[model samples]
Target chain A: MSLTRRELLKFSSIAAVALAATGCSLTEPTSENPESMGSVGMGTPAELAETDAPKVVIVGGGWSGLSIAKYTKKFAPNAEVILVEQRTEFMSCPLSNLWVVDAIKLEFLMHDYLQASRENNYTFFNATVVGVDKTQKIISTSDGDIAYDYLVLAPGIDYDYSEWTSDPVLERRLRTEYPAGFKPGSEHISLRNKVLDFEEGNFILTVPSGNYRCLPAPYERACLIADYFKKEGIEGKVILLDENPNITIKQDGFRSAFEKLYGDYIEYLPGSKIINFDLDNKKVETEFGEIIEFADAAFYPKVRGSKLLEIAGVAKDSRFNKMEADINVFTYEVNGYPEIYCTGDARPMGFSKSGNTANTEGVYVAKQIAAKINGKKEMPAWESPLTICFSAVAMEPILAISINAGYAYDEKQKAFGFTDVYANEKWDGRVGKNNGKGLMEWAKGMYRDMFNA
Target chain B: MKRRSFLKVVSATGMMIAINPSMINQVLRADDGRLYKSYARVQLLNAEGTPMTEQMLETSENYVFNYPYEGTTTLLINLPNESAKDVSLKDEFGEAYLWKGGVGSRRTIVAYSGICPHQLTHINKKDSFITYRKKGERFEGHVVCDGHTSVYDPEHGCKVMKGKAPQPMASIVLEVGDDNTLYAVGVLGPDKYHEFFKSFRRELKEQFGSKRNAKKEVVSTAVAMRLSAYTQEVIQL
Candidate 1:
C-alpha cells in the first residue's frame, strides 16, 4: 500500500474541494455536519459554529500523542486539536526502573493531562479509541465518533504471548500472577513490592529478544534489584535470563556493572529461550531442556503494535507487527493515507523504540501536518533524534552510568543514522551520583515540553 | 533603559560574575546604583554570604548568584521591574516583604527553591533550567525542567504556569538585615524535608508554649548540604 506523488496531489485537490464545500476554513468554526459538533469537544457549540477550522485527532496520550497535541495546538492555534487517551493520568515507562526498586515514589512518575490540555488549548477526552474510519475521516471512540482532518495513531505496544503459551488459562495466569511489569501501573507496582518482599530465594527476570521499549531498562532493573539486595543484606540470587545473545544496548556499562557490582548476586545467561512455563510448580522450561525454578518471576513477552493498528488496517505482516508508514521519514504518514500518521513505538523506523525517539518523532509529525495544512512547499529535512539513557548501577551511593547518542538524517538513505554514539565510558562516580538527579530534571523538562508547554 | 534591556544587561553581568568572582567587586564599583536600586532592592549574595553590590549587577546582565545554605541551594536573581510582582499578601515580615513590590529601599526580592518542583532535580542559571522571560510588556520568571519543560511562575507563589508540574516551586522567604544582607528565614510550598521540618518546628513550639525556651537550632551548613543532596537523590529516584 503506497501513495504516489500524483495520487497524493489528486487527493489533495479533492480534499480541498471537499473542505471548501464543508466550510472547513479559517473563517468558520462549525463543520457541515451538526452530528460531529455534539461529539467533538472543540468548544461550546455556539463558539464552534462561528469558525471552520481543521481538526486533528490524536489517539493515545503517551509520549507521542502528548507531544503531537502540544505542537499541533502551538503551530496552528485555530486548529481544533482533540487528544483521546484512555488513561486519565500519564505514567512514564522511562526511568520506571527507579520505581520498581522503590527508589522513587509512584506519585513522582504520574502526571495529569489537564495542564497540557488547558495550556495548549486542546480538548482532552479520556476515552478508548475503538476504530479508525479513514474513509469517513472519523474515529469511533467509547465516547462517540469524532471527525478529523488529520488522524495520528500513537496507541503504543501490546504483548504477544501467543508463542510462549497457547493455553488461554495459562496465558491469563502468566499475565496476572507472574506478570511483566513493563507497562506502568498496578502490575509494575505489584512487581516492585514483590521484589522488595522476596527474601532468601531465587528471583528470576527474563528479557525478550529483538526490539522492546526501553532496551536498557531490563538490565537496569536487574542492577537496581541487585543493589537493593546488597543494601538490605539479603541472602539471595537473581537469575537474569536473556533471550538475546548479549546485552543489547549500553552494553559496556551494563556488562561492567554486572561483572563488578552484582558478580555474586546475579547470574547472567544469554541465548536462553523460555519455551513453556509450569505455573503449577512456578518453573520455566528453556528450549535447551533446562528447567529453572523461581519464587518470583517476570517474563517480558514479545511485543507488537497495539491491536488497534490491525483494526486500522496499517499493521505490517511481520513478527513485531508494526505500522507500515511511508518512507518519507520526515513525515510519518501512512503509505496510502496522507491524512493519517502513525508514530511512536507503533511505527517501524530505523530508530530504537524508546520514549525519547517517540517524542522527537511526534514533534516532527506535528510540524509536518502543520506544513501541509499551511500549504508550505519544500518540507524541511528532519533532524536526528537525540537519545540519552541512564542506568542506575548502585543505590547506596546512588550511582548511575549513561549513554548519549545523537542522530543525523542521512539524505542519501532517507533515514536517520547515528552521528555520534558513545556507549559505556569508564563510570564516573560524580556522573553516577548526578545522573540519578539528572534523570528527574530531564523527565520534568520532557513532560513540560510534551504535555504542558 | 527598558526592563527587558536592563535584564539582558544583568544576564550578561551574571555570566561574567559566574566566570570570575572578583569581577563582582569591579562591576559593583562601576555602577551608578540608580537603576539597580530602582529595579532590585536586595543585594544579591553568594552562598558564602558576600553581598553582590549594585555595581556588579550593573556591569553584568545575567548575574545569578548561586547561594547554597542549609543543605539546599537558592538562586537569587535581581528581579527587574518587568519581572512579575504581586503585592497581595501581608505577613509579620512587614507589609513590604509580604508583598512582592519593594518596601522602603529594598525592591521586590524573591528566591525560589533550586530544586525543580516536579522531580526535585536542581535548577540552575548556568544550565538555563531556570530563566526570566519578558513576554511583550509582561515580565515573568520560570523554572524550566530540561527533562520535561515543566514551567513554574515565580509571581504566583511559583505556581505551575505551564508544563507537567503538579505543585508550585517551593519558595524561600527572604529578609534584608539592617546592614543590607539577605537572610533566608523560611521556605514555603513543595520539596520535602525543609517544609516538613519547618512545620514540625512550628507545631512543637506552638504545643510547648512560648516560654519553654525553644531555641532555634541552627543547622551546620555541611549537614544542610548533605541533607539537601540526600533529599534530591531520594526525590529524583
Candidate 2:
C-alpha cells in the first residue's frame, strides 16, 4: 500500500508500540480462508492414519526452532508438527551477559519447553538427533528413526575449535578450564564463579573475529565485568583484546562508554588477535608478539554451525561450516528441496546472527511452509523485522544504551538490508535505564507468547 | 494550500477505499495536531527580567541556556544577517519540517537539543556543547560532544559532520514572543528528556500542593521563567 512519508512515520510509531506490547505475534488471520493462508488439512490425524498426511519435523528447541514449531502448527493446524530437541530446558543466551556480572541470577534465563510444546500442540521429543536421511525422509534420533514429510534445521551454533589445536587433551582442557560461556549451561556458571572469585589483578578477555552469534556481546561482557570490578572495589583491570580493529556494531555508543565511563578500569586493545594461550603461565600471546599475563581469562572462541550441518552435507566449508540455503527470500524455502528449510545461526543469511533475528525468521519460515501446504502459489514478503539490542554500561542504577534497526528484504540483492531511517539509533543513561527495564518486560512477553500462547 | 489539507482531500477521495478506515482516521488525527506535546517552555531572559532582543543575540555567535527541567540544555544559533536565509529542515522522525527565518525576521534564529545524541552528555562549562570558529577564511559551527569528539554541523540541520555519531542531534522547536523573547515550545526529535521533565514536574506538584511557599522554595527562577514562557507559547501556538 502506498503511504506518504508522514503516514509512514505515524504507522511505524504505532507498529513499534504494538510490537513492544505483543512480543512476536505476527500471524495474519488464518480462520477466514485456510487455503489462502497456506496448504492445510494435509497433515490431519485421519490422513496420517491413512499414511497420506504430511509430518513436519523441527530439530532443536532454541529460539528459532521453538518459534517455527509453534507457528507451523498455528498457521497450518492439520500438519503433524513434531519438535526434536536434545535439551528439555530452554536457557536464553540473549541476556545472559547480565548473569556474568552477578547482576541477574542464572535461574532467570532458564525455561521449560514442556509448556511451549503443550501450548503449541506439537509433539516434543527430548532426544539427540544423530543423523538425517534426506533420501528416506527420516531423522535418526538416539531413541529411534522418526519419519518426516519435511525437515527444518535450527541447531544453533558451535565453537570452531579447529584453529586452537588438534590435541584432544588440549581441547578437553579448553572446554573445561577456559570455557567460552557462549552456550548456556555449566560453563556459564563456571565463568560467573570465576568473575566473583577474581580479585585485584589484570583479568583478560579475548574476542574472536568474523561472524559469531551476538556481535555486541563481548563488548557488553567487558563493560559488565568492569562495572562489577568497580562496584566490588577490586583494584583490577579488564584488559579487552579484540580481533577486530574496533567495536563492530554501535561503535559510537560503546566507544564513548569505554572512554568516558570505564576508561581507567577497561584497557581496550583492538586489532590484538590471540595467537595462542599459555594456560600454565596464565598468559596470552597476541599476533603482534605481545605476551600479556592475566589472573584469569574468558576466551570467546570463533563460532560456526553445529556439526550436524557438516554431517547432513549442507555446510560448504569446515572452518565456518554454515548451511547454504537456496531460499526464496519471500517463501523461505530451499529451492531444490521444498520440504527442507534451514534457519537461525546455522543458515547463511545476510542478516546478523542474533536471537531476535532468528526468532523473526522462524516465524517467517513457518508461515511460508503453511502457505505452501495450503496450495498458495506465493506468500508476501515480510516487512523488515526490527532487531532491538540493549547494552548495559553500568549496573548500580542499571544504565544501558540501546541500538535498534529495522531490516527489509532487498529483492534485487536477494538479501535483507537495513534502512537508514531506523538504523543505528541509540539512547543512553536514564532513557537507557528505562530500556534496560523494558528488556526484562520484553523477555517476559516473549516467553509468554512462545509458551503460554 | 496546506499540505495537511491536500492530504485530507486525497485520502478521503482516493486512498480511503484501498486503506483501512481506522488507519485513515489515525493519519488524519495525527496531521490535525502537533506531533509532539510541549513539556516545558523556558523564557529566554537575562538575570534582569527583560526580554532577550535581536541586538543582544547578535553580539554572540551562539548562546547556551540551561533548561530548568532535568538540567537539559538548549543551544541557540544567531545566524549572520547577510548569510541568513530561509532554511527548512526535517526532524529526525521526518514527521514535520521546521522552518527558520520568519515572524520577527530580525535574524534567522534556531535552537538544537544541547545533549549529545551519541551518549546523552549535557552541555556544561567543562565541556562546551557547540563551538563556532573560522576554518581558514569561512565561518563554521560544530555541535561538539565532550564525551566523544562527535561533531555535528549546526547550520546543516545538525547532521553529523564528523566523528562516530549515528544520527543527527534533535531539533528544539522555538517561538519568538511578541516581546522578542525566545520560548522553547516543543522538540521534534528524541523527546526522552522532555518526558523525564514531565514526570519530574508531576512529582514536584505531588510533593508541594498549591502552597506558594513550597513552590517558591522548590522551583528555581530559571525554571519558573521557562514554565511561564511555555504557557505563553502554548497560547500563541
Candidate 3:
C-alpha cells in the first residue's frame, strides 16, 4: 500500500499513449496477499468508467472546476472529463453567511456532485491530490495516479496564519478552536454554534488583508451575525477586528448597514491588528497596545494559494500572495509545462477571488482546451472574467447591495483592471426587497449553470 | 474522421449516452427555412383573448408570451426599426445556425425566448430581470438581462451587444397569418429548453402546480401578455 518516490517515477515513464495498446498499467494484478509489494508503486489505478477518449483531468470541484468540467465536455464531446475533489458533496461558500444565521437552510447551499456529473457528462472522482508529475502528466492522488491529456489544477486558497504566529501549537489551536468559517463545511457549523450559544458577551471576528476569497464575505458575515443577535434581543456585541484599513468592497452599503441597523449590536474597528492572542483567558492584544477581551472568536488570517501548488512544483510567490501558480497570467498555463493549466483562486491574478470570477474564467479556459483538442489552429479570442458580487446588508427583509464588472488586461501595469464597473451600494436608504431577491437569484443561476440542477 | 462529421452522426442519431438529455442543438434549416421541428402552432393573443396582429402590437411595450412549452417564456416585441436579415448565430456550444428576420410587412415584429441564453435567467412571476429595453434607458434599444448585464440586439437576431452572454438569445420563429393574426410556429437556432427544464424544476413546480405540467408542450393557443403584467416586480437595474 506504500509507494516509494522512485517506484512512482518509474511507473510514470511508460508512454501514456501505449498504455492501452501494450497492456501496461499502473494497476496491480490480482493478489491474494494484502501486503507484499504486488505492484511496483502506489495503490492500484482508480477503477473509473473510462474510455480511450482524450482524458481531461481537472482537480478541484469548486465554482471554477465544476464549470470547466461541464463545458470542456460540452465543447469537446470525445474528451473524458474527470473532476477530482476532496469533499464528498458540494457546499457553496457564496451565500453561506445567510445559512450561518439560519436565514437559509443548509440544503440551499448543498448540491450533489453525482447529479452534476450525470447531467454534464463528466466523472466526479472524490480524492485529494497529493502531488503532480509535470514531466509525465500524471497526477498523484490519495487513491491512485491519473494520467491526463490536459491537466487543470484549481485548488483554492489556504489560510496563512504565519503572520500572526509561527508556532505550530498556536496555529493548530487557532485552526481547530476558533475555526475561521470562511471555508465550506465543518467550520461554518462551528461558527453557527458559537453565534447560537452566545448569551451576552463580545463575539470577535477578524478580517484579513490582501485579495482574499470573496472580498465582501467577512463584512457580510459580521452584518448577518450581528443582525441575528439584534433580532434575538441578545445583549451580545460583535467586535469586528479588521486588519485592513477599511471595509474592502460595497463599503457604502455595509457601513450604512452597520451604523443604521446593527449599530448597538456591532462595533466596527478598522486597523485593530491582533498582536497577541490569550486563548486561555479569552483576551487579545492589538498592535497599538490596546487590550480587548472576548467571549468567543473566529480568527481569520491572511491567505495564499493552496499548498497543492507548491507540492506540484508550479508555485511562485506573487506580489500579494505566496505559493501561487507560476503560470502565464494571460494563457493560464505553466511556464514550461504545455497543456497544464492552473485556475480558480489558486491563480496569482489580482482579480477579486470570488465564485463568479472563477466560473467565468473557467469557461474561457474550457474553450481554449476544447479548441486544442478539436485541432483548431487559432485559440478563441480571450474574454474577461465577470465579477458579479452580491452582499447581504440586512435580514428580516434581507436587503442587499451588489457590484457588476469585467476585467481588462493592462499592458503597462502588467495586471488586470476592472472595467464596465456598476456599483449599487445603496441599502436601507434607497433599496427594497428586490436587491435581496437579486442576491438569491444570482446564486440560484450560478448553481444551475455549474451543476445543471 | 473529422470531429464535426463524427459529432454530426452522434447528435443526429441521439446515441451519445452522456449528452442525450440535451442533444447538441441540431442546426436544421429545412426547405421552408425552419431551423427546428415545428412545435405547437400557438396563436399569440392579447390579455383580452383577441388574436394579436403585428400591426396591433405597439413599440416600446414589453409584450411576452409562452409558446412551445407550458413554462417557457417568449418575448414578443414590435421593434422601432427593421430586424437584420439572415443573421448567422452560434449557440452556447458553438453550433452554427441562421435566424431569418422578423416575419411581417415592416420586419419590425420579432420574438426571442425570454430565457437569457447566458445562464437561464428568465422572466419569472416574482421578478422579471430580463426584458426588452426601449428608448431613454441605459441599455436602450437592446434586450438586456440585468441579472448579469448581458445585452442582446433585438433588431439583429439578438446577437450579444455587450457583456458576457456566450450566445444570442434563442430565437422564436413567428409567422403572420393571411388574416394578419400572428402565430409562433417553431424555435429558431439553438435554445436552452432542456437546461431550463432541468435547472428550474423547483420554480416550475411552485409556479405551475407540478414540474411535469411545466414541461408539457404548448398546444393550439397561448395567451400573450405584457412583461409587467406577467410578473409582479420588474426591478429595472
- Using DockQ, give the best candidate's number: 3
What would the TM-score be for candidate 2 when compared with the true structure?
Answer: 0.58
Native contacts retained, all candidates in order? 0.19, 0.00, 0.56
Residues A99-217, candidate 3: write the lDDT tens digits: 88889989889999999999899999999887666655667677777767899999998999998999999999999999998789999999989888888899999998877788898
- Identify the candidate with maximal lDDT: 3
**Candidate 1 chain A, poorest ten consecutive residues by summed lDDT:** A41-50
Superior candidate under DockQ, 1 versus 3: 3
* Candidate 2 CAPRI grade: incorrect
Q: Pick the candidate with the highest TM-score.
A: 3
After superposition, candidate 1 runs with Cα above 4 Å error: A1-51, A318-328, A408-416, A424-428, B1-63, B66-237
Chain A vs. true chain A, TM-score per model, equals: 0.85, 0.83, 0.91
Docking class of 1: incorrect
RMSD of each: 13.3, 14.7, 7.5
Per-residue lDDT of B27 in model 2:
22
Cα misplacement distance, residue B126 of candidate 1 (Å): 12
| Decreasing DockQ order of the candidates | 3, 1, 2
Worst 10 residues of 2 chain A by lDDT: A38-47
Worst 10 residues of 3 chain A by lDDT: A33-42
TM-score, every prediction: 0.64, 0.58, 0.89
Cα lDDT tens digits, model 3, B1-237, are 112211231233323221211222333233332234456567888899998887778886888888778899898899988888767766665555666788788889999998998888998777788888889987889999877778999888899988778888877878777788988887765678888888888889999999889888887788888888999888666
